[model samples]
Target: MAAQFRRMAMWTWPGAVYNEHPQRMVERLQEGHVDIVIPYICGQRDGHTCWTAEEYDERLRAIIEEAHRADMKVHACFDEVNAYRAMPVYDLRQVRKDGSIGSVLCHANPAVVDYVLDKLRWTLAEFDCDGINLEDGYIFNQNTIYDPAHTTGELFQVVPVCYCSYCQEHAPIEKPEWAQWKQEQLTALIAAESALVRKQKPGAPFSVAARMPYDRSFYAPHKQEVPYFDGWEVCQSRDALMADWAAWLRRGHIDFACPMSYFHSRRLVELETQECRHLSPTAANDIWIGLGLGECTAEYRQGNGDDPATENAKDPALRNDGAAIEALLLDQLRVGQEKVVFFSYEHLLDEHLSVMARYR
Candidate 1:
């Protein structure tokens, strides 16, 4: 018989993998009734890979074998352009409007796209994982600078980016040209990656960890005092970020559009799911509602007015909020969301696991 829900667990933090063996982790995931595990494999943060490529390979294989034994699948997750290994070329990295070099690599750069696609090909070929998930890379960043005034870097990824030589040279000189170019570049990248994934894996799922669907009235800048809250939405604007994920869905590049709706409120979560269902072409299991079980404003689950008080925390930790977590897990199930990928396994404590196990 089919399970209650196809629970997919995400594991992004390298610290979790670094501390515990892959076998032990998969065992815990099985306990949570997880059918799939999406792990951060070739991700880079703070200017370094958490482990060597050899170590990643060994760890990934260990995870795959262990997960398969437990009847669970492992989808090795790849960070698109943001988590690149290295970009020595100045033109490869994005340039901020302030004339400073941006942290994220240029999406439009052929060398950058080539490197990412080659890396994706290599990882899928090397790792005996069941599937794949892609995330990040889309942020044009400082859209709120124009849309919603009182700006601070805390909300967005600092400022608008990717005025690099590549974009400047290739893009036509016109108003809104840069944003349009950015969207095309990312779409093209997804298409290429999707083609490659389908060719190589044949049956493996190509999932994308996209931002929640845009609803201007419900979102900040339109409603809330602050505009760019990471907990509520991905960016100030999807167009500004060039995250045309709805179109990607229409194009059918992604098998699953996992919206990262990491909001604390149940009402907000429902709103995001509704928006996703209304906007996206895919339905059922294809719209994987990503509940923020990891590190976000994850405590309260209430209707409490339109915009309730929210706390957005960056320090990744599993708080003692079993009641809230359970509510999210079961509520999504109640609403008939066939698949829900919890933001992470790393932040899930023993209590959280207990709640997860009992949900099934």
Candidate 2:
């Protein structure tokens, strides 16, 4: 059999549930034969947030150096708004109707854009890294819409944004409004950031984590609905999402697009790989599909905690071992995608490392 595709592991500093330090995580990755490390710099959960630059620089730097020694590229993850709903900088325009702040910011606001750009600039200046990954940066609620009560033609939606009195004061003036305007704002923000980064470091890599839409009308009606911005489901279908991403790639906005293919079964991976190949021929050659190692295990599928399952869900008596992960990696290589990234390193253990080692 042909050698399997190379593997990249994800590591988060200040640690997530596993609480592994960067140095130790690096060691594990090296042993696993990982070719790249995508370290999580910042992320949000509920109301709490974690960032490595402030507290774990010493450890982070050490890990980066070690990975470099091992010939591994380091990809820094800047999570703009994954879950906790906080931006590095706050925008006054993204206030909610109830007079409270929202989790995400309005990309239309210059201040928000500046805040993100500054952060990216700082990261490139500070780190000796290969590239940067912008995770969930362009994400917005599909239920959002233009609010006439707040401002004329002002874009509003169910995302509960820009209620800080500024956006409310300057709502848009146009009627027969469309939520596409908001999407355009977001796309512009992404493009601008990508441009700025490239200007500073030509050929540096950039990517966005986009939601997968299965069909054109999947997010319709709700595509631009307020309080939720529901229409995204229509425009963000799988084909549409790929097409949108193709435009970015064609424009040379990003070096690669890593779609979140969070599938549990090997079959699903095969199917998605075919679809991606068909939708993005160029990206298919360069794309690195993101898979959830911690979440795809048999124990995870059975809804059991992290405990190992007695038998494989697909084959009882065939213990849930490193074989499952090996199968996944092999499948990725079979589909012509050479690069595969694990969701996180902090969540991995010795067993996970062993599985990754098989491919290496």
Candidate 3:
């Protein structure tokens, strides 16, 4: 049953195996029955890149070969715009409306887009892997900047962004269509990368790890604005990040739309699973629902106060019960069309593996 679902695991570099014990970790993954392994090759977060220049290539090939030897497929996972591990190459900062900088790749800049295409091709060529997952982090906030001069090395901002001269020239901000243009930029970027991947490796699968909606309500952006906030301004899925993933699936840009539905409650998990299925019923098999194991819990499920009680933290449902975990897994499986992929392997325990192995 797990084989039917394409059981996969994600591996990040500069940690555990990538840094040390590469072969051992592969062996461990085999024990867990992980059929596909997605490795984080290049990324920049907090200030450190995942792989260093010297050992990046050699080490990645080694890990890939190890996974292959274990009869596991290696899917290249690229951290889109979130972490530029190969810094300075595509580290064009995103400038917010307040003139602050955010550490994300500016998709509006032609150079950055070109760099992404090149990088996608390079990763496919160098790695010689099975396929690719154009991983998310495509800017949840509107504070994106295209002007290179405003690169202040600042973090994410709460305000809107990119009223710069370059953005103005390419996409006039004063126009009501500016938001649509931004969404197009992201969609185009993915489309270009997908085309390259197909050209490089014919018929290879391409998947995307996307953010899932918490509920029917999309009012997080308007929480503080209260009385001044007009009801239902724009769908968060459409505008903020411009992740029209259903369209991507419908357009055949990605083989699978894996929503990271990391909810603690089995009810919410079922709701999200159904939502993904409803997003594109015709392409229902293409949707893979990502479940969070280990210490993953939703904030809403957590109590309202400081050090609030949480289900996974306190209850045995998500904590220690193999039956509980199995029940949740079965709930998602009940969707019939949707596949399941856990967030990580490190967080999973022995009981988790035992239950998962049954499905395998």
Give per-residue CA lDDT, model 2, range 45-112, as digits (tens).
Answer: 34334543345555556767877877888877766543343444544334555666554655566777
Candidates' TM-scores? 0.83, 0.72, 0.80
Which ten contiguous residues of candidate 1 have the minimum total lDDT? 145-154
- Candidate 3: give the clashing pairs: 44-83
CA lDDT scores, all candidates in order: 0.65, 0.55, 0.61
- Model 2 ranges off by over 4 Å: 6-19, 43-53, 81-88, 91-101, 143-177, 214-244, 296-321
Measured with C-alpha atoms, the lDDT of residue 298 in candidate 3 is 43
What global local distance difference test value does model 3 have? 0.61
Q: Could you give the candidate ranking by lDDT, starting with the highest? A: 1, 3, 2
Q: Can you write out model 1's per-residue Cα lDDT over 148-202, one digit (the tens) per residue? A: 1112223333466667787778865346676687788888988889999999999
**Which digits, one per residue and each the tens of the lDDT, describe model 3 over residues 199-314?**
99998889887765522344344345221122112213555556777778878898887777655557656666766766777534687677666545442333211222323233
